[model samples]
Structures are given as C-alpha cells and as structure tokens.
Target: MFRLVVACVLISVSLCDDLISVVVIYRHGDRTPIQPYPRDPYRNASYWPVGFGQLTNLGKQHHFQLGQWLRQRYGGFLSPHYSERDFYIRSTDVDRTLMSAEANLAGLYPPKADQVWDPTLPWQPIPVHTTPELEDNLLAMKKYCPKYNSLLTQLFKTEFFLNISRENRDLYAYLSKNSGAQIASLESLEYLYNTLYIESLNKFVLPDWTSGVYPEKMAPWARFSFATQCYTEELARLKTGPLFNEIVEHFRNATKNDGFRKFLVFSGHDVTIANVLNTMGAFEYHCPPYASTIMFELRRNSSFYLNIFYKNSTQVQKIALKGCDFDCDFDDFIRILKPVLITRKQWDLECQNSNFGDFNTIFIYSSIAIGFLISISLLWVIIACFKQVKTNSNDYTRLAIDEVA
Candidate 1:
C-alpha cells in the first residue's frame, strides 16, 4: 500500500508541470512566552536568559531547519548562488520574527566564493525588511480596527458565542482567581495557555490542578476562542484583507511578468498565518502552530495556474480556495479573491478611525483649548471694568473737594 501511494504521488508530480514562482507565509518558531499571568509564581525576568518574550536558541534552530527544508524543496527552482533580484524577504517588526527570517535566509542562501566577506564565516547577512509595529496591518494582530472590533462585539452577542461564554464561565472564573487577571476573555486564555505550554516545555512542574483532564478541556476552548475572533466573513475581510491583497498581487505580477522573483518570503506570527488561511477559506479549527507555513506556487502548464499547500506542523496538505479546485486556475483564483482585496482608502480609514478614539481625542483637546481662551477673555473684561469704575470714583471725589473750597 505504501509503494502504491508513493507511485501515485510521483506520477501526479510528473504530470503537474513547471513551477514559475513561489510565495510563502510562515509563522515564527517557538519562543519564550510574551508575558506571564499576573499571579504566576515565576513572574520574574530573572528566569529567562534574554528576559521576557524573546526567542530562545531552540527557536533559532527551528527556523534554521525550515530554511534548510526550503532549500531542499526549491533547489531546482532557485539559483544556487543568491541574487538580489531573485529573492525578497519581509518580516514583522518583532525581534523573534526578524531573527527567524534571518535564520531562514541563512539556510536558503549561504556564502560562496566572492560573496563571502570573511574566510572564517560561512554565513552571509541577508536583509529582511520590516515596518513599524504600530503601522503594521498585514500581520493583523496588533492593528486597531474599529469596524473589526464592532463586528466582534456583535459576534460576541450572538447566541453561538453566548453559549460558549456561559458554558466556560466557571472555567474562566477559576483561571482569573489563580492567574490574578480581572475579566478573563479569550485573549487571556490564549496567553495563559501559552505560558503553561512554554513552562511545560522548559520542564517546570505544573500545579496538580492541570494534571490530566483539565488541560485537555481548557486547550480546545482556547483554540476555539481564537478561531472565533475572525469567524465572520466581514471580520475576516477586514483583518486579512491587506495580506490577501499582497499575495494576490504577487501572483498576478508573477504571471504577468513571467515570474519576476523566484521566492517571496514573509515571516510573521501565528495570527498572520491563521488570517491568511481563513481568508482563503482553507483554515482548520485549530490555532496555527509555531513554524507553520502556507505556500502559493505559480505553475505554468498549458497556461498559468496556482497550487496552494499548507504545512500545519510536519505534513504538507493541499488546500483550495472557495469556488475553485485544488490546483486553482489563475483567472478563477483572482476573481474569487477580488472582494477581499483591501483598498488604500479603506485601510487608512480603519487605522485613522480605530476603536481607540482618534476623533474623540482631537475633539476633547480642541474643546479644552477653546474653553480656556473664552475664560481668559471674560476675566480680562471684568478686570478692565473694575479699574474704570475706580478711576470714575476718584475723579468725582476731587471735583466735590474743589467745589467746597
């Protein structure tokens, strides 16, 4: 049976035709938890080497291995020597993600001959581009979108989410009391799970309360909560739109220009991966694991087509966009994704009008300034009137004394 399956796979690849270009979006590898629970015993920064929320040596290795895998898989497509024109890399403005991109680039492109600056160092520095964290919308996590938040508020009020919230009420209360957090939400659970997961990996002994069935129950809800955040079509469009537009443009350009670049690499967080996958209508229920990747391959057979592959952790699975087959045709793929392509105006408006109250802040400051000016003018008028009254009174007293003389 194994031989037969292998034979079929080989035959399918043989029939699939030529690879033109590749775009990959991947999650950064394992790292120290970004933060600890408020009441956790190990809350001190002294416990970690680089302090809170930094990538560990293990995370570096994970990304390095991924780079090697990319090298192995795309060896036939990419040039043996690195060319500035052939490859591009972008990462989120975070230490872990930036470092991961550099590590991955190291595996993808190693120094050779003239490209080597030093005889001792085998690796060469590859540039990874990034924007400011506050300005990032492509990654979707830290972006403040009022429209998206409004959608989430409505979603939370739905019967579906209400049931989930009510069912997990006891669990949330227990977590809040133990973790020293007020009003535990889905985000809190995610952070809590991350802490526990990382601690367990580090060989720390967890409390007996998390021993067997408790963790099992908590894990699913946490994952479900994350998935629910962008569950709706509108929310998904708003959150994932920028990224989807970029990927589609890359595909379109690759086809139009006959594959301008060999590889377009994006290094980002798990939320980044989930948002893109969800936008494609290919997302599974679980949260995206560390070091996961989704690849879009532009292939040219009789004409241009796209092949989408997802690696959740270890295995690569093929996924299709909605209204398209596994190996989606270029035209059909473009049409299906058209509605979610983020416009420049829409993104700017969302960023400018986020739920954090940009308009309200301007109004409040302006109102205070205006009120202060009006009060100053009123005080000046009253002082001037009092001085005039005193002058008139003095003149009248002098006139009376002269008449009496």
Candidate 2:
C-alpha cells in the first residue's frame, strides 16, 4: 500500500509543467452593518461606532489568524516579499473587503528588512486592485459556481423573488427617501417618495412578511455578488479582461497543461462561494464562513483537485485544513463536495483529541459541568448563611426591648 501510494503521488506530480497562478477572493472579517433601516431592530447609529459595514477588531483578528494559517500552509507558494513576477490580489473597492485583503496579506507576507512597519518593523503594504461596483461579474461567480449567473437569470424572475421581502426594510425606508420618486401601494394610493411609487404596482411584496422589503435576499446578493465577481475579474486583470478569457484559461491550463502555482488560494464569502458553485452547477449547502478560503491544486497529468477550509482562530491550530473535489465532469472528474461547518473550538478539539474509540469529549464536558455545579452550590450556601444571621439579629433586638419593658 505504501509503495502504491508513493507511485500514485509521483505520477500526479509529473502531469503539469511550470505555469502557476492563483486568485484569492474573500470577504473582510466581521463588520458592523453599514446602515439599518428606520425600523430595523438595531437601527441606532451608535449600535456600531464605526457606523456599520466596517471591519471590527474581531474581524481583523479572524483574518489575521487565517493569514497565519496561509503562511504555514503555503510557505513557499507565495513570497514573503512583493515580487512583480509573482502573486496578484484584488478586492471590491468597499472599505471592509479592501481591508480584509490587507489583513490577510499582513499574515501571508510578514515584514522583511526592506518592508518595515513605520521604521520599527519591516512590513510593507501590499496593493489590492478593485473594480467599478455595478458591473456584471459572472466571471467571479464562476469560480465556485459556474452556473450561478444563468441560474440567477432563471431565479431572478421566479416566485422566489417575491418571497425575499421579510427581513429587508430598505423597500419602504427608501420610499419617501431622497425626496424623490412617487410611492404608492396597490390597495391605497399613498404619497410618492422613492421610485417604488412607480415600481410598487410593478413590484409585489417580497418573500418576507415585513412591509419594508427591497428583497432582503438581493441586499445580501449584491454583497456576495461583488465577492464572486472579484475572483474572475481579478484573475483576468492579471492578464487581460473577460475578452481574453484568462480566468478559465488559467484554471484549465494549470490543471491540464503546466504545473502552475503549487497551491492556489481564493479568499471570499459564502455567497460568492454559493453563487459561483451554483453557476458552475457546484451546489454546496454550506454558506462560506467569514475568512473562509477555497484552494485549488493541480495534480497528476492534468487532473485537478479542490478543497475548502474556513478560519476562525486567533492563533494557528496544529492541524491541516481539509479539502473536497470540485464537481466537474465525471469522465472529467465531477464528484460530491459535501458542505461542512468548522469552528475554532471544534477544530482545536479535533486536533488535541484524534484518538478513535476514545470518549474524551464526553468525559471533558461532563467533568466541566460537575465542577460548575459544585462551585455554584458553595456560593449559594455562603449567601444563605449571611441572610439568616441578619434575620436573627432583628429578632434578638425585639426580645431585648420586651425584657427592658
């Protein structure tokens, strides 16, 4: 078995020539919502000092941990220093996404003698190229889901669109907003404010029961759409635009022809991951986690492999990120890519205790619970004794008054 496995590995390595390129698109870490509608549960601006949709300290740490993971996972794949001949990164122009790429870079490429943080440490700022917001990014979505756009064209007009109104209040709030556009409801002719007045008759309620609806799914769609679009666009930007079709060419070439980069990483969100896979007919029930990463490795004579891993740690755990194959053609290599959710605690626990047939988790949990109960009981007893003493003092004072009388 060992000999056979070694032979198989050698056969796989000989397949591709030297031609490596990688495109990683990921969402910025956890951020405050950009803004909430007037009726939103958490609409107060003070809810987030950064004023919504901005990266928080936690978000930074999440990406920072991922950066460390990448450094370990792909030590030589990416350079510690910037080089014109290798490596390219792009993000949507939004502050959060842009900053996410930067944070990831800080981990991927730590400071060097030439690249220092302010004159103290050598850390250089790597650039993240961006694109215009509204442009169609079918290319980006194609990364994980090649079939998403065509699927979107189908999903766009489905009854599903009407079902998305519940959580989104942007629909009504935008109305009478900007002091523009006539606003009206079907049953009652109401005051016109945003374009909804003209569009409401044309528009029906979204899936959500809430009156305020801009199609809640669409708001999220745009957010993820941009994430997916960047992947394809960023790859193409490295060479030429969509016209050159560098994105597909690169993947196909990497897997079919030459041995491109040792490993390719694309950091992006669950939606982008979902949509791209949806488009490519890669259906994953798993929504991409924050700081989630998708990896592609080309192997054995034009054969390709894909695996996805998520990061949710402040420090590196001494375990490897798992992988799954991309759902391509069977004769061509299409297989099931099951969805999985990995948390830091679970991942850490998995690493520390990998022994099969052992019930360490169960024992650990039970022990912790029993210890907690004991501590609680001791505190309760101490409080009860104090209350009893106070009551006795009051009773004793009354008895002494009776004796004096």
Candidate 3:
C-alpha cells in the first residue's frame, strides 16, 4: 500500500509537470429550487430570499471556496496576475450559473498591482461569455432537439428502465404519497426530491415521512434515474455530444489559436457534469453534489496525454477512461470518443433527422404536396367558370339573332 501510494504521488507529480492545458467543468453551487411541487408549502418564489433559482450568499461562498481551491491547485502554474489571454470563462446564461462563475473568478483572481480600483474590495470583475438562454445549446439542457426527445422516449421503454422502475415500485409509491405531489414517473419523482431537498436545506421543516429511510432510498433512486437517462453509449453521445465536441475542439485548437488560454472553465448544472462523466465512463452512482467538478488536464507526455479527475463535494479522484488508463494518450482518447463525439454541423443534422425519421424533410414534402393539389384544384375551378361565362354569352347571342329575324 505504501509503495502504491508513493507511485501514485510520483505519477501525479510527473503529470503536473507536463500539464499543457486544462478544461474544468463544474456544477453551479446551492440555490433555491427552480420550481416547487404542486402541493409543497413553499411553492412561491417569494418563499426564498433570493427568489426562484437565484444564487444565495451561501452559494456565493460555495463558489468562492471552489475558486480558491482552483487557485491553490494551479496558482504556481498560472500567472500571478489575471490575464484575459491566459483564462477564458463561459457559463449558462441563467442567473445562478453566471453568478457562480463570477463568484469563482473572485476567488481565483483577486486584485493586484494597479488592477486594484479600490483597496476596500479585493475582488475584480471578470467577463463571462454566454448566449441568450433561448439560444444556449451547451450548458442549459433546454435546447429543443426532436431526435434527442425521441431517443429519450425509446430509452424509457428499454429493459434497463423497466428493471429499475420495477425494483423501485414501492419507493415510488411512498414518494408519491408523501412528497406532496403525484409521482407519475422516475423523472417526476426526481422533481419532488429536488424540491424537498432544497426546502429542507433552507431549514424548512420536512414532513415526518422523509426523516430517515426516505432520503436514503430517494437519493439512490435519483441517481439511478439520472444514470439511466444518459448511461447508454448512444444516449450520452446524443445528449452531451456538443459539450464533448467543444472541449475537444478547444484542446485541438490550443496550438493554433493565438494567445491560447491555459484554462477553460464551464459553469453548468448537475446534469451537465453527470452526463459528461457518464460519457467518459467515470460516473459515480450518486448525483453530483452542488459545486461538484470534473477537471480534464491535457499534458505533454512522451506524446500528449489526457488526465481526467473528478471531484464530488470534496474528494478529488483520478478517473480511468473506459478503454485507457488514468493518464491516457490524447490520440487514444480522441479515437475512443470518435464514435460518440459529433461536429456542430452533424448535431444540427441529427436534430432534424436521427435516421429513425426525418420529420423536417417529411413536413416539407407534405406541405409541398398539399400546396400542389390546392393549386391544381384552383386552376380547374377558374377554367370551368370561364367556359360557363362563354357558353352563357353565346346563348344570349343566339336569342338576339332569333328576335331580329
């Protein structure tokens, strides 16, 4: 055991020495529930101090701590002064995630030199890039993709889902009765748990039924549901392909992009972390805790290598890839991901047509066919009316000639 520990430490040191770039994807910190169950006591946004889905002071502190940890881990490697050229940050356009990134940056880079505008405040503003919430496809899972939706429907009917649901039937019944909402499915049950967990965390008194076994059982159920949602090779690829593609693109372009930043930070949700981890075969059965993070460091070993590290709440562990070691060759990593990874263009195409069916193309063809039939009918009507008018005029002429004779 002692030798093993020492060897692990030496390997970590070697990897750190060769580290060339990093990408950190993290969940936003604690926040008020985005919504509440129908029968919950705290259904209104007014119940929380920060309103619905906004970050609280505690959340700020959580992210601030995370930022400080990042600094401690990479401070020696990063420039002492904050540089736009050295670091880049992006987050979901939502309030909590965007705020979390800002809070994190506050801890990551404090004011230095003439950068200090006011001695009273040690913090400085850092720009975070984001698209409008409606247009956002990377972090927020709200983007509408018909193919993904269809795939998810098919997933729910698979044997895996059936087995898990059968096993948890009793738990589902209990949750439905006690969770103050009708739990129609595992996804609905998860919503109830999320509300209960957040409300309880905010010091709201939970119902007597949720005291002990309920939470324990519900936690696993939640993880199982989440895992089933994206565990399959195909499901993970479709749901998280864009994010995976973005990370790889950043790494691949590191050499070509001018003034390449050493760090790329993504502030996102628990789903984001879980799905990405699942794709890499590094997922834990537990749902990622608030402020959880996964760090992928690209290192220049004999050949370039990718080292993936996962942190849940506090403990950070090295995650071995499915087909490779913990520190896998970058080329090998890319090859392993090739089947799952997709380009932005391919993603758009898949969204329109998943090969199962092309709804967009079908809709277009159906519209054209309907339009052609309508045009032909209108032309026939016009020709018939013109012939009737000419026939009436000729009859009138014949009557006039008879009267003149």
* Segments in model 2 whose C-alpha atoms lie over 4 Å from true places: 1-22, 117-119, 136-246, 252-269, 301-405
lDDT of 2 by residue, 238-321 (tens): 211231233344565565546443333344444544444433333334335467654433323243432222232232111112
Please identify which of the two predictions, 2 or 3, would achieve the higher lDDT against the true structure: 3
Report, for every candidate in turn, its global Cα lDDT versus the true structure: 0.78, 0.45, 0.80
Residue range with the least summed lDDT across 10 consecutive positions in model 1: 8-17
Q: How far out, in Å, is residue 62 in model 3? A: 1.1
Expressed as tens digits, the lDDT of each residue in 1-405 for candidate 3 is 324433543445332456678899999999998887666777877788888888989999999999988887777677657888889999988899999999999999998998999999999988999987656666675667777778888888889878877987887777777666777677777777787888888889886777854477777777766676576777776678778888888888764454568899999988888888888887777778889999988876467778788888888887888999876788888899888888767776777665446667778888999999999999999999999999988873355446653
Full candidate order by TM-score, most accurate first: 3, 1, 2
- In model 1, which residue pairs have backbone atoms overlapping below 3 Å? none
TM-score of each: 0.82, 0.49, 0.85
Give the best candidate by lDDT.
3
- The better-scoring model by TM-score among 2 and 3 is 3
